[model samples]
Target chain A: MDKESYIFNKFKNSLNGDDGAVVGKCVYSKDLFVEGVHFRREWMSLTQIATKSMLVNISDAIAMNAVPKYALLGVSLPKDISVGEIDELTNGFLKIAREYGVQIIGGDTISDEKIVISITIISKTKNPIYRKGASNGDLLAFTGNLGDVKKEFEILENGGKISNDSKFYIPNLKDKFFYKVAKFINAAMDISDGLSKDLSRLLKVNSLGFKPLLKLSKDELCSGEEYEILFAFKPKFKDKILKIACKTNTKITIFGQCVELDENTKFINKCKEHHF
Target chain B: MDKESYIFNKFKNSLNGDDGAVVGKCVYSKDLFVEGVHFRREWMSLTQIATKSMLVNISDAIAMNAVPKYALLGVSLPKDISVGEIDELTNGFLKIAREYGVQIIGGDTISDEKIVISITIISKTKNPIYRKGASNGDLLAFTGNLGDVKKEFEILENGGKISNDSKFYIPNLKDKFFYKVAKFINAAMDISDGLSKDLSRLLKVNSLGFKPLLKLSKDELCSGEEYEILFAFKPKFKDKILKIACKTNTKITIFGQCVELDENTKFINKCKEHHF
Candidate 1:
């Protein structure tokens, strides 16, 4: 086993091995957004950085079909950060929090060389979707489009101007649509570390394999930080799920189906791992 | 108002303004321990650093009369951190977590310049004690002793020899005794930013004042990072609280009484403000 799996297996009985930890009726999730690793200071304003940090964590809770409620923020600021910039960051946090009805209750801050924002979101859910419940014939689906983020990333990398309204910085999550179809879904996970990587994680837990039916580019399959929901359901519920997606104004695409593990099934394992 | 208060007040209605956020029967708390701010790399081993990070966050939950159940860790490691060091850190986390019965659920890790460990502990308590319930004539008390931590800190800072079993690295918490007195306590908070500063926070919320009778030294009242529980109760429950403390093999010190605000009563605001 790798280092993370070895460590996680030590306490596997108590852990849910899902996007968030299920404790009673509440689900707790945490995410870290480092300055140079996740985004550069020159790429966006501090306000945008703060907003994105909150959204990424909120998305994790949403992926579990949970109602986002409370958030605890941990921030490490550089020496050159100004008071006005701190205000901007606070406003950014408050703005997104207010939109989601999540209260920023408590947090800790300290001095560091660069900005490190860590957010932990607590939400409520009765029936949480786990990544280990997919059956052999369950259909795999994903919300929103893929591969577009890589286009924006390339423009930013080449010192080119991308649109200010790019979805890369601010992802439009379809949380309500997920809630509408929560009971029908068998398994789900957020596509933060790309579809191929996250799908491998979801399938490995159940000793299953996948065969893609739709054509997808390499960028769509391997690019990270999509923040979209990838889920599975029985083929019989396809029409109901599609009806709900239409009613909630969400775009979902069926891409693959879970199958029994065999030598002929090709598994993609070349995706990026966020933490080394 | 200061920056932190101004920011907190904006969401004060939705917050409890306590050591942790109260959601249903669970209390969630988050804290950040950054290298060079909380501890120096040369002063301790990676195990000590990792253990201290978990303990400090657990201390907050204990102060609220909560039984710690789950923990989510967010770690930012430097590039030079080896796999063996990661194992050491995980062992440290597992060791302390086992002692508190807090299961390591899920977390995210990333690479950064310095080692930043942010821990979020979720604990349960049916009746959580807040810092705004102290009334006039209520007795103020504290667990364990103070002023000794400064001596140990001085020894460490001066490059002198100190015992490896120092309380500066690991605190002995009396969580059971606190739960026994949870119903009787009126107000409480952990003495993290020093007794004087934290006491000021506890009383300011209720428009109350405190006059210490123990004749504590400046170091006792002003030293930060002393994770002792400071609490208040009616004078009528003092005997019962002392009885429980004695039965639990814990020490209790009654040092003051809550009084009405007046010019004769002095307030000490000299304690450290961690995030300015």
Candidate 2:
């Protein structure tokens, strides 16, 4: 197992393996975006960095069909950070919070050698969708294009610049489509850690596997940081989902269907792990 | 102003300066404990590090008169971290959660060069006490002894050893006393950044100053990471607070009273700032 999975499995019994933990009507989720580890300072501006940090966290709440209500940010900044940089970082967070109608509650700030941010998003969901609800014969689909993020990531790593509109800079979360189709979907999650890896998790929770309907390359299958919605539903709801997708202006890709687990249940992830 | 305060001041209109943010009946708080910034690995075990991180976050909730119900931990581990060390780290978090009847909901973990933890505690409060309610002539008091944590911190900095039971290792939180006296106290906070610095915040919010009733040295006044309760209450409830303190087996020292601000409203914080 990967180190992140190993560490997460240790607390499996005490915590849920869903996109976010549900307590009553509240869904709590946290994500960390650290300097050097998650992104290079040269690759993106502080506003882009901070904006992605909040968006990725908000994506978790949206995946759970929750409306993010508030956010608490934990930022570890560098010692020589300037006032302009601080303004940019705070403005980045404020802009996203305003767009999502999320209250910037409270958090802690400390000094470190790099800029590290850990954000907690508290969302509300009257009808929450967990990752464990997929069943046999359920149609599985993902939103938007995938392989593009991996291409962007490689370009940035090689001293090449990508467009400001790259998903690496700002993830296009499918909150509107997800919320409208939440009641129709059985299981769902945001594809932050690529399709294969994240889909493996969705399958594992239901003790099921997938039968791919469309052929996808390793580049597409293992593209991480694509904040697209991966979801499953009864095959009968496919038409309804497609209708909502058009209404919400979302591009839905019907990639696979849930099936009984096989001997090859393990999904190979060739993408470089972002954490370690 | 310090960089931390300056950054926070920019968001003053949006976020609360309270120990935790109150959203309806829920209180949310986040705190970061980074390696080198918060402690050296040589000075603390992984268990001690994890334990202290959890306790400090809990202090925020308790200071707001809230009971922590769920915690989301964001841990950044070194690349060479071992399986055994992961167990020790998780065990530390589990132990505290069990003690407080808190659920370890969900969190994100990543790889870095050193251990960095940012924890978000979601607490519940029927009636939360804020830092803006202190009135003129209200008495201010702190729990337990002060200055000991600073002495221990200096000892560790100089390669000197201290007892394991030092307050630096395990802060004796006044949750029991604070909860019982929640209705009586006008304002409250935990003194993580020294008595003088934290007291200045409480007074500033209430538009008040303080008159010291007892003599205190710079060491006692400027000791940081003490994690003791600093609170204000009306003089009429002094006896009641004392009675609750005795019943709860807490040490209460009434050392100051709130008064009108003077030219000396600017309190001197000679203690080294924890965050730049």
Question: Cα-based RMSD of the predictions, in order?
Answer: 2.0, 1.6
Cα deviation of B71, candidate 1, in Å: 1.0
| Residue range A1-276, candidate 2, lDDT tens digits | 588888788777535788899989999999999898889999999999989999999999999999999888889998899989999999999999999998887888888899999999999999999998999999989998888999999999899999998889999999989999998999999998899888988988888977889998888788998999899999998899999999999999998888888876444456665557
lDDT score, candidate 2, position A222: 88
| Docking verdict class for candidate 2 | medium
Candidate 1 global lDDT: 0.85
TM-score of 1: 0.95
Q: Please report how far candidate 2 places residue B11 from its true position, in Å.
A: 2.2
Q: What TM-score does candidate 2 get on C-alpha atoms? A: 0.97
For B1-276, candidate 2 gives per-residue lDDT tens digits of 488888777667535788999989998889999999989999998988988999999999999999999899899999899989998999999988898888887898898899999999989999898888898899999999999999999999999998987899988898889999999989999999999889888888888877889998888998999999899999999999999999999999999999888876444556565557
Model 2 has an lDDT value of 0.89
Colliding pairs, model 2: none
RMSD of 2: 1.6
Instruction: Provide TM-scores for the models.
Output: 0.95, 0.97
